[model samples]
Target: MRTSTFLMSIIVLVAIMCKNVVNGAIAEGGWMTYCQDKTKAPEGALFACFRSNDGGIHYNGRDLTSSVIYSNPSKANEIAVVLQGHGASAKFWTNDHTVQVYVKDGSSVNYSIKPRQGEGRVNSSVYSSSDADVVIGK
Candidate 1:
């Protein structure tokens, strides 16, 4: 009887975890790369940028769209610009780390990622339909 009870408890725990993942309550740490500019920056630093898709979830329990930029080779310094909306598109500057992101809800954001700064951090900005575009550089 004790063994049966333990097995039942384990099954219940697994079911709960599965439910959270399916409902987008848990972050899978997966991102889809939208653009990668191989061009080198000043001081011979290389940078790569990525944008999140519809599967991402924000900390506030809303749909997430983000642009992540990191230093190449080491990836020691990184920055993330996130927005709370669906449908995101990214455009990168030629031979530079600057990127502009456009959200489907008539919202857009831009950022410039620096190299060898420190740990990665997320910068969240709020926007309304009237805002149209937002820029957050460096």
Candidate 2:
């Protein structure tokens, strides 16, 4: 009984350690800067992003839309009007998923992947249907 219990504990510990290693690798590989659809993600994978301390813009659809980030399927909660003094924005590209973002100051953009339910989309006035980076409308 003691041996079995010890073995089980070791297995659990190993699992936890392995998860951390994988998460670190993913973040280091730039998974932190993009958004991810959790359902399609690996079992224990986590997304991470880099934050900037420069300057950011807060935006609203009507009058508050300056330097802000927007998404398609337009949801108020999904956009960024004010990104604080952090980075511009970050995006992550997964196997079959990709999210794109625009920044006023391209170098300042820093962002991470956000887990969402269903399909995810961002909308903003800057997103041109003709732009090759996006695919929601096409």
Per-residue lDDT of 40-136 in model 2, one digit per residue for the tens?
3233322222122222212334432122333322232232222322233334333333333434442233232322243655433342212222222
Task: State the C-alpha lDDT per candidate.
Answer: 0.35, 0.34
Local error of candidate 1 at residue 47 (angstroms): 22
Where in model 2 is the C-alpha error above 4 Å?
A: 28-138
Q: After superposition, how far is residue 110 of candidate 1 from its true place, in Å?
A: 16
Q: What's the lDDT for residue 136 in model 2?
A: 25
Cα deviation in Å at residue 86, candidate 2? 32
Tell me how far candidate 1 lies from the true structure as C-alpha RMSD in angstroms: 14.1
